[model samples]
Target: MTSTPPDDFDAVVGAAPSAVTTPTLEHTAEHAAEPRGSRFDDWWARTVYTPARQRLWYWGAPLAVTLLAAVLRLWNLGNPHVLVFDETFYVKDSYTLMHLGYEASWPADADTKFNAGDTDIFTSAPSFVAHPPFGKWMISLGLAVFGAGNSVGWRISTAIVGILAVVLVMLIARRLFRSTLVATIAGLLMAVDGHAIVMSRVALLDGSVMFLALLAFGCLLLDRGWFQRRLDAKVARRRLAGGPADWGPTLWWRPWLLTAAVLLGLCSGVKWSGLYFLAFFAVYVVVVDAVARRRAGIPFWISASILKQGPATFLLMVPLALVTYIATWTGWLVTSGGYYRHWAQTDGQPWAGALNWVPLWFQNLWHYQTAMYGYSINLHVPHPYQANPLTWLFMIRPTSMYYAGSSLGQNGCASANCSSAITSIGNPLIWWAAAACAFYLVYRLARYREWKVGLILMGLAAGYLPWLLYTGRTVFQFYTIAFEPYLILGLAFVISLIIGTRTDAAWRRKRGLLVTAIFLAFVLAISVFFYPLWTGQQVPFWYWQLHIWLPSWR
Candidate 1:
């Protein structure tokens, strides 16, 4: 006895009653054939497409989930007062960058001094920083508002970015599934996930990278809808005017696409890996445009997209992104004390001939970027927590950001042994389920050609696939934070599949709902079980060991 097709499946492929009906382009064709005033169309508009209801969910759901995220991220944010993990680099860099307009050198005892409220230990000498300044700049905002010596100031920006990321996941899920319930589930998963919580509570660049990339993705989703509406309207006008409809008009004004490009540029400003998203999504946009044109009955859709619209789209996106990326270097550029700021005028060879007119500052910036790239790719120093990208999906080795073991009568230890630790391990149930769901999504996308699944996979690809090439590099599982949102989204999609439509037989719906509720309950329970480890809460040694089901997790 098969269950009815889910409402989300109908929303994506078009409404169908039979459980065995495979979604195909024919559903789109049938949808196009329906009259504007048809009973089904009117009913859909009145119920599912109600503007008032959409507006409420659009504003209300994101805020509700963001508040939950805020509490999770901001509570006890300053615990373990010393810098955790790479916060040693970012938090200090942020303080110096705030004062000197460039990352400055600090003494070997800087961490000890800084933690003891001696925050003014940075010197005027420039430090050779690997990543761009944007993320550190974001961290500086919190430092400026709250004192730099305050631990909360070190992480407040990332915590806020994490909260905003939850909202983005909800908004993006809503756009993809067109269901408030699915959107809320996605947001709730992001809010409660240990990986997200740990990343937010620390001063690290990856969370900022995740937030910017996710925001760019949301912008692209908006662009997809906007492009479709504009295409339809222009095609209708052309047919009404009796003009040839062999090729659709080239759309030069894509506001959302421009916005996505800028956001992606800022994402790259946080980390060079963000360029992968820009490259992947640019190709995705072209493909989506070709499909949209083909569906509008344009015979030369592929050729038109490639030849006519492609160059225009590239100009609208790439150049603006380049500018935005350069804008992020304004502080580095304006400061003469930055490392390699005068390379072209001193040790570096200046360009000859037509390019000799290039500014020395731009040449020096280019030289600095090359040096950064070289350092980044060649970094292979072995570390205890450096997990292979192959093990990242399984989370075999989560990074231990901070850990302090106490024997009895030390640091408030009541038990024989107490441990306060912050581990960047994801909730096992959520992480494993997401990993499994991702594989299923790949198969589903191939079989049904669902654009939504493809889009989600594209995000995962942008965040995860790039690291597969760098297996030899010293990387940690915490890097998965960059792609965790897509993981949550994939999991949410599978959940929707489980909770079949209301139109299913009463028994089927009841079973489906029961299964979904139980799974979510387990997920939440696992999150609670691991919260102490994720947040550095003190717990007995055995209790901490209990959360570590696998030896590698230690």
Candidate 2:
């Protein structure tokens, strides 16, 4: 008789079960002598045969967590009603981009005038912006819908993207760990984390980069599974034809990879740091393909993947990404008044000979891009909240985006002094714990060689490691928002290990569950404590001081 599969079986093994089969003793013996074409048959079987009832949790759980994220990001979004931190640049630029088709130069008193409802203070002359226009275009959508002077309008698009990011994290975690509970834990952490909260609530380009990079990561994860299934089928066909598995077939039709390329291009269009993700993940894809081929018993897996398939993958991803990146400048490209829009025709020399055929507009764009790159790399201006990337993961020196003080009788203040502030600080327990978990994951990846662990670490590396080269370039801890999702995912992975398996001793299972519950409760409690600071909520000056655990945070 065949037995029922355990509900938590996938949780323990980190993958779906192979197809279940009930066969006679004689039939089982006969099949044991035959060669199987591929190892993924069981995975396909389990997937195809999954109960309809179990599938509801797949969408249901993630959507619930995303609802929590929406509430946190959208509540009182217009509080303080002023340009906070870098919003002085992004929000004003977005307002002008909506009106003028590109970022236009604003007068010295533009913020004061714009805040006082004089929203039309920009000139037609282009501003030399450090970042690209895609993120600003997104912000322009919100400004268009709600009017430019409304603070909620200034930040609604980012809030929505932030909510969607929480759902993506849940879905990706579900795929990686094969556990809905673990996935929910990851989403909850991101939902309540103060850094994610502040980044979502403010109008900044980094939030767009974070969401796009994460969406690209999700696409890549989907591609990994799709590639494996297709490779298995092809390998099975070859083995059935009595052929040697010398090299795997090159599979070119990858929709997820193509989607990822476009997303990464748009990401880079928002902020150039997004290119680091594309570069890192491209290498990761080639490595994963080699391993997949090796697992399918290909004798020449390494050379076949590196030499034969690598070029094909590059052709599929890089050129498409470049095209997409250029397409993001449509507004600037078509318009005449953008910064350096006619440089090649006037101030700069255009290419001669064969390259002379290139359009003056295209050459002008190239010149403008190079200038933007030079400015970004060489920037060393000092600011009070500028943080070293080395201390980012620890939440030391969190950036203060906005702050206002009130006397006892002003603005509903009840204490001798009151404070309302927006601090981009992560919850202390969650951040410190996630940091410790990330270090442990590095060891776990080395010891066990789990692809999921490597993938999570790669996400962290893509968002973070590149910044180390520019420590002198005036970066801030708030930039950590880009990789903060991966940190929560890493934390979730460790939590899975702590929760143990249903197969473990009853006492062990109970202890694990109890511990996880207590930890989550504390995380929730800390989120409540810090929510006031994360938003610009007024509190007693001493109470606000209590929330600052470290001197550096102030």
Candidate 3:
């Protein structure tokens, strides 16, 4: 049966006709012609078309899930008391940055002093930190508010960003699937995932990177809608004016894309690895632009998209990201005391001659970036916990951030030699199932040409594939935290497929719903079982052993 289009499909495209438009729904002939008998098909169409219900659930449901996520992250956030894993570097750096406006070098025993509740452990000299300073600045914001002496202050920002990430995943899933129910499932999955929970509670740069990258991805999704609206409006205007409407109108101003550029820049600011996202998104948006023009009947859509429009889009996105990235170094840029801040003056570098006209601060900033790049590429130092990128998906090795063994009488240990640990493991069910689902998504994307599956795949590729090139380097599985949401999203998308559209045969829909519920229940149960490990709660030795399913997990 041919189901009806949403009543407001045209209204969404033409709501701001002067600013945006779409060709008729008929323009997407291939997608429109696909048969839709499944219950999912009917529900998705209604959710997409019913503006009132969409508005109600989109923010309302996702925000509720985010609240649940926040409670989980914030509760017992200060438990570890002492610095854990990379927090030894980041939390102290944040404390220093808060007081001095730049990261300062610490004495060899800085960790000892700081962990003992003595916060003044820094020296007068600047620290030669590898990553950019903005992430530390965010940590410093929390420290400044809550007093750097406390563990909660060190972790609060990460927790907040982590919760916000859940909201972003929900919104992005909603936009991709056009179903609030699926979006809620994605958000809830993220909310409870052990990896996300652990990252949130620890003062690490990766959580901030995850939040910014996810935010940028959300902006790109919004931009897709924004661009489509403009495309439809242009076609509508031309036809009404009795002008040729075969070719789509050119879109020069894309504020949402610009917004995405800024967020992507911030993602890079958190970690240079975010550069991959910038590269992926730049290509993704331009291709999307070209496809929009093609669907609107442009005879030269390829030339129009690649030539006429591509360069302008690149100019708007790439350079803006560069500027935003530079802006993130504002503290280091203005200060004369950061390490290598005087490289141009001291080293007499040859590049200085060409850049002599530029301000000394900027020249030195360039020199610092060069030094950072050198340090990054050549970093092959061995780490005990470092796992190859190949095993990150399988989670063959999870980094242990904090671990302690307790006797029967100490620290509320209920058994002989109980254990408390914070292990950066994902929810096993979610990670294992999603890893399997990702393969299916690849087939769906290629064979069925499913756009949503493509989005999930692109995210995973941008976040995961880049690591494959650096496996010889000292990368860790914790880095997977950056792309874990996309994996969850792929899993949710498949589950939505299984739930089949409301128009499908009753038995098929019932079975699909039952299977989906069982899968989610198992995921939640795994999360509960692993929660103690995620939050550093002590559990019986045997219980911990049972949670460790694979031998490598040890």
Candidate 4:
């Protein structure tokens, strides 16, 4: 203390070193203002070892992964020399509609002749068919482009759309999970699934339904994001102004929602059952909006959404869908001989306009819908392959699309006892694991509030559970395409848990990643093993026999 007292004799320095002091309070504010990590904060650094190279993981890897998926799906698309499954119905309907301008009745015993490459059996005049022509419309496009090319023509549409679906899976999974790895995983899984591939190679409505449902689902996801962002910006503005945010924030009219509506209309145009997804998703969008409002701390959010947002959403979705559905009937409306085409001209009519050319026929369509409803709801026929929702996971008694035995030396015969057939079986590893994953999801929904668990549950519910209630109706597991995208989502969710969301403790994270890699490898391997059956390849009878793990599979 004595040594520090000099400063220009009185002030050599403004203050002696011993007298100088720093304040302990300076760091108080820094400590208070520092950001404490939420559980996700340490995710990337802890789990993703490549820190400076994060961009490569998202963009570059997905492109590479998608290529792998494409090769698996697109190669050897033509195998079965004959139409597989219901390719007979949709493919032939497409041709009949194209040639006749409407569905024409077939001569008795037409299939034997038609399958013989003789197209002369379809008769003139309208044939009363149950389903609308839009699905056939799409099938016709494929045939027109790729006609009678055998496997090429019959399966072209499904193959192309299946490829497109892989692209969609990448986009949806990337957006939902925000991880490129998760998206690539989803795409790869979809690409390798035996059911999806078999369905793709055959002309069927379920693949188209899958496409439309996936499109609408993607749109709803986009709309939810847009709505939430609009809320956030409004909240930020209010906070900056030092005032509580107003409850009514202006929302942009969402075209994606409209796109979703129109796609659903097209879906309904294909099959009336598509309306179920439209109804469920329409209500789902409103609930999502309400939640977004509540999370933004908007008081009276329920009424705010119900009164202001709900009507606009409905107008944009349901009624617009109704209008589009009616538009799908334009061809029928123009034709007088359509099955119910005379409703307006019938002697006693409830709604009048026949003389105006718009006709009571339009009104009669309402009555026709009632009849269609009865047929769908009251259908209770038992069949060998009529599997219940409880057993769908196992892929037992899978639907056989086509079966014929060729004597040795005829077409595909590697054995003295020749066998040639096509069976629409699922990839056992992927589906079985999905079942286990879904079982886990069901458990977690009761115990933990996981977003993936709940969202995936909706799709499975809409597609599978509804069928359970309608078990009295003729239903099949092949219809599961309605929910395949979400099933993939559920699988991706489990993958996410295994990978620990790009962040986790060292041991847990390592184990999770190992499991994901192992599962993916196993799934791809299974796809290769089943590629013969999926594509109708002419493997030896014994080679085909290798895939029939169960006696029921026969």
Clash count for each candidate, listed in order shown: 0, 2, 19, 8
Error of 3 at 156 (Å): 0.4
Per-residue C-alpha lDDT of model 3 across residues 226-312, encoded as one tens digit per residue: 898888788788888988754456677998899889998988998998999999988888888888887777778887788877888
Which residue pairs clash in candidate 1? none
Considering lDDT, which of the candidate structures 2 and 3 is the better prediction for this target? 2
TM-scores for every predicted model: 0.91, 0.91, 0.88, 0.83
Query: How high a TM-score does candidate 1 get?
Result: 0.91
Q: Give the Å error, residue 67, model 2.
A: 1.8
lDDT (0 to 1) per candidate = 0.86, 0.87, 0.82, 0.71
**Candidate 1 off by > 4 Å:** 1-63
**Pairing residues by index, what is the TM-score of model 4?**
0.83
Error of 1 at 148 (Å): 0.7
Q: What pairs collide in candidate 2? A: 18-42, 19-42
Model 3 score (lDDT): 0.82
lDDT string, candidate 1, 163-217, tens digits: 9888888778877776666778899999999999999999999999999999889
For model 3, the stretches where C-alpha displacement exceeds 4 angstroms are 1-63, 235-249, 350-353
Winner by lDDT between candidate 3 and candidate 1 = 1
Candidate 4: misplaced stretches above 4 Å?
Answer: 1-60, 64-73, 148-151, 234-252, 346-358, 445-452, 501-503
User: Model 3: what TM-score?
Assistant: 0.88
Candidate 2 lDDT at 329 equals 95
RMSD of each: 6.3, 7.2, 6.9, 12.4
